[model samples]
Target: MNKLSLFYLLVMVALIQISVPAITVYQNEMVLYKGSEFLFKTIPLDPSDPFRGKYVTLRFEEEEFETLDTSLWQRNESVYILIDKGVDGFARVKRLSRKPMSGNSNYFKGRIKSFYLADGKAIISLDFPFKRYYMKESKAPRAEAAFERALRDSGQQTFAVTHIKNGKSVLVDVKIGEISLKDVVSESKND
Candidate 1:
């Protein structure tokens, strides 16, 4: 092909490649800034993935939902989890749906980790999309230690601050009470 044609082709390919990630970042930024915020109670532990590096693995208390029809859901199926604030102000699963809510924006996408019948009700365990809060290699171990200590204390509250909009969610921060986990680690270092 002509050099001018080749140049145009390469430029088109490059634009297409860049646009995908650009759109993703834009969407995530929008969610972080303009989306509704929810606090999800967390039980965390530290783990290192060889490919992804160090992160605090988060398990939410609001991962299970019960329904009467077990046949409607399947393992590993993508689902929309509708959330609403509980009496204590933490996010709770309001319902699950196969399709996105038409007029509501208070849902995030997740997968069904597993399900089982119990007392004729289907108990579904969900796999949240945002489960890893990555930290610098140096800070992760300290953060995990502090998180565990906070979790052990009955009075301390550990939770993740997440923002959700249009089926997308961003994990803003993990906090113990009003202080963030990063701040907690930093404070421990100062002590």
Candidate 2:
């Protein structure tokens, strides 16, 4: 192939590699937004990345599987987890199954972390798909600081707004005390 042709091919390949995941994420998010929305309580931490800008590290509240049967469980095993709103109005894991079930409940695909025990409970650690919510560089710091202050206040709660569809999940927003991070930053600007 000609040098110019080869160069163009390389560039196209690189672009595809970079853009495919981003495009997939956007598409998945759109699906989630159009589907069922769920809430999961979270503890947020902020950190900056040179390439991806700043994002909040999300640790979900429902990481422990209270009634999981470990007999058939294996390290790094893939599982389909059912999601339903709890009495507190937060989305929580209803069950883990080897295959996705059809019903009104939402589901997400996750992997089981290696065998472990905690507090006399047979814990099944889950690795959720969406862990970080990327934010604009300028706004991330403000959001982080606000979240930290809210965390210190006993009245505030931090939670992630997640949406699920067809066993796919997306993190739509991170909220502090019922206000979204973006809105909180904008509200601060008016004060």
Candidate 3:
């Protein structure tokens, strides 16, 4: 190829690389059990950014993981979450633990907190990195509908938030509280 063409190609490739979101592996490679459930005790947080829109941020309290064999598991690796909760209470998630509960003195009780699956990452939903996920008004119709359906079926507000198994994210479901999300858009309209 000509030098000018080669330079242009290189620039295009560089820009593409820079623009893509970098995949961050979980500090502890763990996979959540597919049929398990969760109930996180939400620790209230302050408003983040306008771009994020609105959502009731959370810190998970109960993370019920699928019982898996020690051999199939990996330490600190991320696994896909499945099955959201219903109004009755409880959300099911994939069993993804940092390390096996084997030989540990502490019991992996239902009180297990600080873990969630969103945006293709296994998040602990802590102070430092896990951030509120919000979506544009135009996108919420489908996203909210699916979320609502899952919530209805489970009879709980707790989410069975799952990651894309194929690793190709056509639509990343940004969780926004129904009330909070409505308020943000409605207030703007009234104004």
How many backbone clashes does every candidate have?
0, 0, 30
lDDT of 3 by residue, 41-102 (tens): 22323233566564434344433342323324333444333334546454334343443344
lDDT of each: 0.91, 0.81, 0.37
| Decreasing lDDT order of the candidates | 1, 2, 3
Q: At residue 69, what lDDT does model 1 achieve?
A: 66
Q: Pick the candidate with the highest lDDT.
A: 1
- Lowest summed lDDT across 10 adjacent residues in model 2 is found at 63-72
Q: What is the TM-score of each candidate against the true structure?
A: 0.92, 0.78, 0.33
Tens digit of per-residue lDDT, candidate 2, span 41-158 = 8876788788988887888878767763545578899988898899989988878888878865488888987556656555787878778889877887788777787788765878
lDDT of 2 at 75: 81
Superposed Cα RMSD, model 3: 12.0
Instruction: Choose 1 or 3, whichever is better by lDDT.
Output: 1
RMSD of each: 1.7, 3.5, 12.0
**Candidate 2 regions with alpha-carbon error over 4 angstroms:** 1-26, 117-121, 189-191
TM-score of structure candidate 1: 0.92
